[model samples]
Target: MPRVVKPKDVRRAEVLDRALALFLERGYENVSLNDLLAVSGTSKGAFYHYFPSKEALVVALAQRSAGEAFEVLRPVFDQPGKNALERLNAGLAASYQVKLGMGVPEPIAAMRSLLMPENQALFRKIVTIWEDLFRPVLTEVITQGVREGVFDTFDPEGVGDMIQGFAASIQDYLVRMFDAADAKSRRKTIDDCVKRLKLYGIATDRILGLPDGATVVLERKQVEAMMTLFMPSRPAGSLP
Candidate 1:
């Protein structure tokens, strides 16, 4: 019997799945087109038929991941009969659950890689994509909170932008702390995120499903070790 042929979309997904695994195992910069083709078990011609280039593949991966994340929280924002605070809490929880379920570290590691000077453009693009995807949803939620008297922010849109910026900064800080192998920095980063959230008029109880004054204890050594495995190769003494 002749070998079965996969559909174009199926083949493309297979390539992406393999490439994502390889990129997760090795940093994005370290993974070449040849490496992707080799791991994906697809001919160069077939790979090009889908991705065109490695950068395109990375962009697709980022966009797909962001789209999935947005979809996970979209229902929470759209759900009726829930107040702003409840909806916001549900959105946050849904996001956390999705990340947990994915169980893949490449998305976060890829963001860390984009922070490098060489990948500045890609990083900016990713940030813009995230802002575009999240800002309006956040603005709607904040506006609802303001009308419901649960939140008293004067500028809902500005607050949404700030929240997105704060979240990005926190993610970057966590990656840096992990790269530096500093447990204290990791702890401090979490504390700083909480402080900033409170400053934004987000009630502590409405954040991350954590109670007010809840203590967050992370196993720093283990997490640092895990991050070290994914840390991009850099010159000695260079900041992450």
Candidate 2:
């Protein structure tokens, strides 16, 4: 057989997923280009064709994470027969359900790996992916809120930036939560995370001129579900 040619998208996704699985398990910095190529079964030139550099490859993974999150949020934001306030609240809950420590094993592993201190630069790149993918759509929703007289912002873009900045500032706490050494410390960090989320929601309401409880940026039960991921794994052969 003349060499079988996979569709470009299929081949690229195959290489990407396989290589990313390796990176997640091995840690990104521990895996070199040759290692990625070996695990992915692609030649150097072929890997270069799909990803210009190692950084680009990991950036794509970050984009995939953000893309998954937005996919969950976008429909809620765009739901028919829903006003901006309703849609915004729904989107916020939906995102809280999926992102954070949402129990999807791959993303949890990927996040843990990326948030490693050695991967700080890569984590920063991922943050940009999230911001780029999140901001414009939110600005549109903010515009909708303004048009509906549901919000009191003259500049939807500025308010949107403020919301994103507030959310980003809380990210350091998340890193600390992941870094917590013991179950008690992790539990405390989780509480701090929840309080920060509540504060951010309140800030959003104030910025948009809605009542303090108007925006549902997070919910108690949903966060309770997400926090289970941070619980230290039980020792082997211990209580279930």
Candidate 3:
């Protein structure tokens, strides 16, 4: 019997899936193209055929991950049964659940990597891609809230931008706190973020579905290990 050959798209997807797992396990910079090919069980030619460089691979992975997140939340915005705020809250809860289910540190590792000055260009490109992809969805949700009188903001587009900026700031703050091994500061920052969102007309109850004064808790040792893996230069200390 002749050996079966995979379709081009299937082969490309398999390579990407394997590469993503490798990148998530070992930080992107720590994994070379040869390492990716080795883990993916793909020839150098096939790897190059799909991704010309490691940077391209990273971009592809980011796009796919971001796209999946969007898909997960998109329906909440489109579905008609729920009120605007409820939909928004459901979408956020679902997103958080997805992140927790992955049990991977890709988000933290990728964010830390992008914060480095050397990755500034790639970071900017990714920011642009995410802004383009998410802005419309967020804007639509905000617009729905405004129409339903749930949000007082007159300018949905501007409010959407502010919301995105706020979320980004919180994420950056968490990354910094994780680096510093300051879990107390991390929890405080999360509370502060929730309070600020309330000021923006977001209901306190829908503040990412987090309980009062409580934030998503991760295993301290696991988080510390991930921080060390992604940011080795930071001084180690016990998590607060």
- Residue-wise lDDT of candidate 3 within 1-240, one digit each (tens)? 998999988888898888766655565567888899899888888888988988888788768767776777688667788776676666655654453334456665555655655455555555666667778877787778778777666667776676556544444544555444455765464455445544433333233332342222223444444444545455456323
- lDDT over C-alpha atoms for residue 157 of model 2: 85
Model 1 has a clash total of: 0
How far out, in Å, is residue 172 in model 3? 2.5
Off by over 4 Å in 1: 100-127, 145-155, 179-240
| Better candidate number, 1 or 2, judged by TM-score | 2
User: Model 2: per-residue lDDT, tens digit, 128-193?
Assistant: 888788888888998999999999888888887777677666657657866667767766766777
- Best prediction by lDDT: 2
**Models sorted by TM-score, best on top:** 2, 1, 3
Q: Rate the local accuracy (lDDT) of all candidates.
A: 0.64, 0.75, 0.61
The best candidate in terms of TM-score: 2
Q: How should the candidates be ordered by lDDT, best one leading?
A: 2, 1, 3
Worst 10 residues of 1 by lDDT: 213-222
State the lDDT of candidate 1 residue by residue for 1-240, as single tens digits: 999999999888888888877765666667878899899998999889998899898787777777877887799777899988777767755654453334366555655555555555555556677678888998898788888887667788887776566555545544555445454664565455445545433333333233553312223343343344345453223322
Q: Candidate 3 deviates by what RMSD?
A: 6.7
